[model samples]
Target: MAWVVAGVVCVLYFAGTARPGYLLVRDFVTVPDPVLGAAALGRDGAAPRAVPLDAITAVLDPVVPAALQQRLLLVGSVLLLGAGVGMLVRSRGWPAVVTATVVATWNPYVVERLLLGQAPTLLGVAALPWLVIACRPGPYRSQLARALLAALPAALTPFGSVLAVATLALVTTATSGARRAAAVALPSLILCVPWVVPALAGAPTRSAAQGADAFAARQDSGLGLVGSVLTWGGIWAPGAHLSSRAEVVPMLAALALVLVVAASAILAVRGGGRRAAALVLAWSVPPVLVLALATPVGLSVMEVLQQVPGLALFRDTHRLLGVSVVGGAVLAGLLVARTTRSLSPPAVTAAVALIVSVVVTTVPDGPRRLHAAYTPVAFPSEWADAVSSVPAESRHVLVLPWQAIRPPLPGGRVPFLDPVPRALEPPTVTSRDLVVRRADGPVLVPEGEPEIRLDDPTQARRALDSRQIDVVWWWGVPESEPPPGFVTVHDGSQITVWRRGGDPRSQLPRGILRPSTD
Candidate 1:
């Protein structure tokens, strides 16, 4: 059953595969930056993000044939998910387990989420069933497998780890022994050390612990919130999606599935007072809280909650929808098993297969369009040459465009992609700052991330000196030449590089920091 669903999902994923071109949209950028490594380890920023996926990406590096990278991840993830769901319903026999597998793998929302590049969160989703298994009364061998299963998602993100832990707590497990809890938790901690230690250090991303705007549901109303969960719209991040087009059929499908899940869980809980059924319903709390935050009262409550560290890790509330989907599938499986028990084996098989086919086929072809967005770009030789020319000790070059700021974007201020920050090597500081234009003028405010505004030569140089910037790499041809004492090293069609006093590491008098009023 798992194999059948896994094969179908893999085919669906690869259907969109294209080389050198697969890298399209913000989600697909393959920039080379090492600061993320530092950030992941909790060394630099006050609010550093968890980057388990980034670590895997770094390991895959230039060796893994850049074009195939996302494909590999996409395929591996869906297969693991299919298998995990299959194992969860394995005791249910043919029709029930098969139906659950289809429900889990027939993930239309997952396509949109993947397009938005929620890879780390998706890994948590895939790890869910295994996390549930770890909570069940089981032998040491099965418990060991549970530990390993718990580790994958735990290593991915804080959100995933919390879900894993919460599930162990919420579900009415027969096993009360601390041994089972210990088995699940111990490996999770060991596996997630790279992220856990840094996050524990009390660093926060600039936007960390911020607000409901970043954390709440994209859709405000209860129905809209429910629909968003059905269609996987919670992340509210930038990505091309069919739901954005108001496609009626998909919207209706989402609403229907939500009903099916709700009804199934209700029936299961009422019928036998099942712990698993209750657990799935409990999973809805996070998304529900996000929806509640749409109101002024809820926003006030969330602000108070923000005082606790790691609480906002799930700010992009859509990440938690994976658990809800899993719960729906589990309950749906139970309903199928009970209602169809009277049918002959062959008849049940045909009926369930037909149902699975209809559900999968009707799903919007969002991933296919996403696959069309694939566009792989080779790293420019000019940037490579510039990096090589710098003195060995030189660290964190500041680019000419000081930071990525924008005119207007739906999610927030994102710089135009001409010279994205990720293109530079580690120790390089580019900007991820939020910028806004005041009604009165052309000035841009530094809203979130730390940024240095160097709109002119002297100010730019002073900003450089204050921070002890090593190299200044500019891609655009500014009307004015660089400041005095700066020696031009390489001026080519792609970029112009300058070394101050023949060294990117040169020092000048200590100066005031770049004024915010600039």
Candidate 2:
């Protein structure tokens, strides 16, 4: 039943995928065929942000279109959240399970992350409840395998890996013994090796201290920053939030809903849920503290913490809040079950209505968000021919305009990362720098990943001068004059491919290579 509810939510949430063209928003760029190269292996003088995900997509490219693959994964993630939460509190009864499913699936955190084009990170968030259930006090022989299976998707990104491993270690140790916990944690550690190896081997990408201040949680309503974070709605990106969150009535009602949920949490803890409550409390403290300290009042605290090695991973801090969310869902299920058993029919209906109203208020325009965030982008048909025309031996294709994020193109309504790198056959060099527009002004965030910025013609010539780039694919508006002494191979309306003299050896490390096909 919970699975059925989840399926409906996914259908409604991602209705935009059914529209024509690819869904290009922020970091969510999917190409039919991705070039597997040094960057895929985290050897391109930068951090392994995509890492194993790119490699996994390349391996599956022959079987499934990358765009469809992403859609399936995203839908599967929501299902995982619903079913996992339902299963965890199944003992509570059907009403509790269903209510928990709706609560967990339709919250501000999930919606905001979706709008931000971060389905990959949500995998780990979805997996947390399941990991808890799998690691519960048990003597089963297949515990290790079950635990690892649940953790696989979460292992795709570093942040996800952290959440998965932490859940495994804590839950297993608390319910079972430390020995069993260690047994499960070992393989979870092994699962993270794909990204861990590259991060350790590659030149370390320096994390900016200013990012702590920049990405701090913002106050979304009259409820303020703490209230906004408590409701799991305050993402730093204004565009990512639902506009309804700005209203007073909805926020107050949302606050009432939070108080009721808090009461439920207390009831659950007092009634034999102490172990689960303890785990949730432990997980909540760090994220809440970090998020609070990232604000203006605690800027000094953040500055001190920012100097700590590897602290860059938690600069956003809000990502870790999923633990509390999952825990809260479990508690909420207990609340529903208890109410159903003791309260009158009228009371139960009112309770259910409260949950539904809060969700509706949180994302008042669900379909609109879907349409806006997943706006279809039609790449020129000539892109295929232009990229194929590049010499097979060419090392890097330097894409021009040198910027990362782009405003709405001819057929698109949302901003997106340049898709040339993923769409083209050869490995491409494009900007990783992100320009985030804030209320004050636009701030150019230099790529934390250690990639060379071809921000100007001088930089482009330098890359060409070094004889590292054999092809220059200029797409969209021309940012500057094309590098000198290069012959134009394909000059179509949308893309123009340029080839320089001589085949230069690739200075960047190489990964697995696949044959190019239409």
Candidate 3:
């Protein structure tokens, strides 16, 4: 039953991926073979957002094809997520299981995150239901062990790791005492060492100056910030969510569902499963707290929190709403179970089917929207050729048109984070600052990634002389020619590779500062 629900959701959401091509959308970039460089280890001077996820991919490149691994991870994450939700409510009966599975997988949060290409983070989120079950009251040692084991998947990304610890702390405390919660929390936190160590060791002095506002949850629908989040639809990225979410009608339907689930959760506490229902309700607090922090006064509070090392990672508060999905699904399952007790089996089946259909079609043409948006793309041949053109001695490869997010590739509409750093052998340097386009104007997220400054010719020359950046892979047409010290080695229609010449002290040409065509 869980597999069926998962399959339906996956087919609806990612059917286009069945065709041969890479799932390159937004920040979701996959390479055939990722380079196991300093950046992958989070030793790069930038933030550790990719962290151990990149390192894990590089390590698995030998045993599994990167593309296949990615497909498996993405699809499998959804499957496991549905299955875990199903397992949580299986004791309630098949109807409960089905309701929980559908509600968990077929929601705005999952859809938005999938479209945004956050497979790793989603994978971590998939473990939440299982973590809840594992933390159930039992022998302290056995419960602690199962809880830690369940948390391993969420530890894949830094955000996921934090979420895992939070979930464990809450659930373990609910079932056991605070002392047991501490026991579980300490070990679960230790699991984050892969990212935490690298982040603390080499993270930049200045994190993103404007990231709090840039990544804060925005009102996607007619519902303002709080209302939008209640419906699980407020994402920072405009295009990342289902287009239907912008409509007042669908958002209203979603809000009604939220109210129904809340009422059902209260009934669940009074009827039975009080602890479970309360815990589910408790899960809503984190997201609400996050939304509170997103407010103007809350952002002022966040400013102080950002001063603490590594706290900046949670700037994107919407992602923290993931646990809310689990809560909503389980509570919805309880609603289905408690309401349908006296109904005939055939009527129950019909009722469940109608509910499922309504839940799916609420966002009209969702599957088609995903299919059209998720077209697979093959990497351009020039990209590989450009990397191969660089000399073996070049230690650092810098991608030009220094946008943190690359402009759309040929035949593609979605722009993604530059894949050059992962594709190349050398440690690659690119802009960490994200440029977000808004109706008003362009907002620059000054995320500090220490790189050669194009504005300061002397600084750029010094970086070249010191071999901090030995090769430049410029994509698209530059406003001006390469400065005297950069000799073009391979110039293709789209990609041009430049290596440092013997004379590194030459002055940079004025034309080098012009805005990139990208």
Candidate 4:
């Protein structure tokens, strides 16, 4: 049974992730576990928020090939999604199994996110159902196994962790054996300490600075955003929007989608699955409320919430939408569970046909669409040239074009990404870059990498002297010149590398520090 479900998941997802593209999106950039303890930290910015999978990645960092490290998560994603929904309809017939798998796996919420390279968010998506299962009554053979499952999402993504706790809380309040649940949940907190301790210490991260709108649920009307999210297609990028207004078919499909959810919730309660039904309902509703408030009427309320320290963490409604997909799928699973009892040919045929029709409507030409959108890339030879110039033993390195920002994907024009300090593979240099998000950020660490403004070259020079940055690779943007008295060691079409010195510049151009446009 397990193998069959796994096989189906692979076949479905491979159409999206395999060959022509895999890990091709920007999300793969954050897979390096940048927050792992090191002698020098990245001044490039606060590391993407830490979660439990980071610790796992960190442990594997030394031995595993870098490409394989992230690929492991990519592979786990489909398995978890398959296994999670499988858990929800395990006893039901093959129609329930096939229908549940397709309904859960083929959604835009999953594929579009994969194209955007949001591995962690998808990891959370895959783990979400299992988290609920581990917390509620189950057939687990051991107490320790359940407890570990309870903590599983906690380790995957921050939002997933909270959602897990929320589900557990709802289940705990209604169950008779509250003591056992409490005891199980308490130790799971211990397991979360790796991520929890760092977060509680208030170690600065890029996440802390995000304004509410940057993380807002949607740019369109609240109701419209709710519709888009429901139909599996609300995204920050404009092109990704699957607008209902664009056509009549989409409008009817979305409306029908809503009716399906409402009907499934009603059916679950009537079908001796009240607790499960309530769990999905509890999970699904908040995303709409959040999107609504983020829109206008409740803007004032969100304003206050944004100000509260640590509250902005929930600001990203897109992440919430991804997490909510499971609830909707489980509800759909319940509806199918009602019909697939006899495993009759007609029942199986209907279920399979329905799932296929939805997939086609939502994601026409899936593999071809993916191929056009997600062509993979490799690091340019220039990156290799620059890293080689930096002495292997250098204590720290800083990068310029340091906005401490998340920019749109530059259309794959560059081989890798911005700020080599953050994305350098076969990472060699130690970095203590400050994580401040201000656009005109005042130089924080002085010389090395903390948003250095050339106007304050004294402080910049002092910052340079104090930290002694080896091989300052200012590559992504054009600059007028290398700072005074810095020896030019390596200059290339994409970057200018410099080491502190008392003498004049090298044979490279004395002024106008720009890389070749080509």
Candidate 3's C-alpha runs over 4 A off are 138-145, 202-205, 272-274, 391-393, 439-441, 449-462, 465-467, 477-481, 509-518
lDDT of 4 by residue, 247-316 (tens): 5554565456556666877766666655765656654675666667567656666556654434544555
Every model's TM-score: 0.78, 0.89, 0.92, 0.76
Question: Which one wins by TM-score: 3 or 4?
Answer: 3
lDDT of each: 0.55, 0.70, 0.75, 0.53
> Candidate 1: where is the Cα deviation over 4 Å?
18-42, 59-69, 139-145, 168-174, 200-211, 220-223, 238-240, 304-312, 344-350, 381-383, 390-392, 400-426, 434-461, 475-480, 484-498, 502-518
Q: TM-score of model 1 relative to the true fold?
A: 0.78
Error of 3 at 454 (Å): 4.5
How many steric clashes between backbone atoms does each model show? 12, 0, 0, 7
By TM-score, how accurate is candidate 3?
Answer: 0.92
Q: Give per-residue CA lDDT, model 3, range 1-518, as digits (tens).
A: 87788888887777777877676777677776677876777765667787788888889989987787778888877888999989988899989999889888888888888778787778888999889899998987898889988988788889888888988997887788799999889877887898777666643624655666777788777777787788777888776767787676677668767876788767766776657666556557756876887788887766665545577777778887778887888888878988889999999999788777666754665677667666777777777777788765677877776566766666566778787777666666676766565546566666554645543456656666676777878877565676667788888888888887766654444434333211
RMSD of each: 5.8, 5.4, 2.5, 6.2
In candidate 4, position 213 carries an lDDT of 44
Q: Give the TM-score of candidate 4.
A: 0.76
Clashing pairs in 2: none
Question: For model 1, what is the alpha-carbon lDDT of residue 305?
Answer: 57
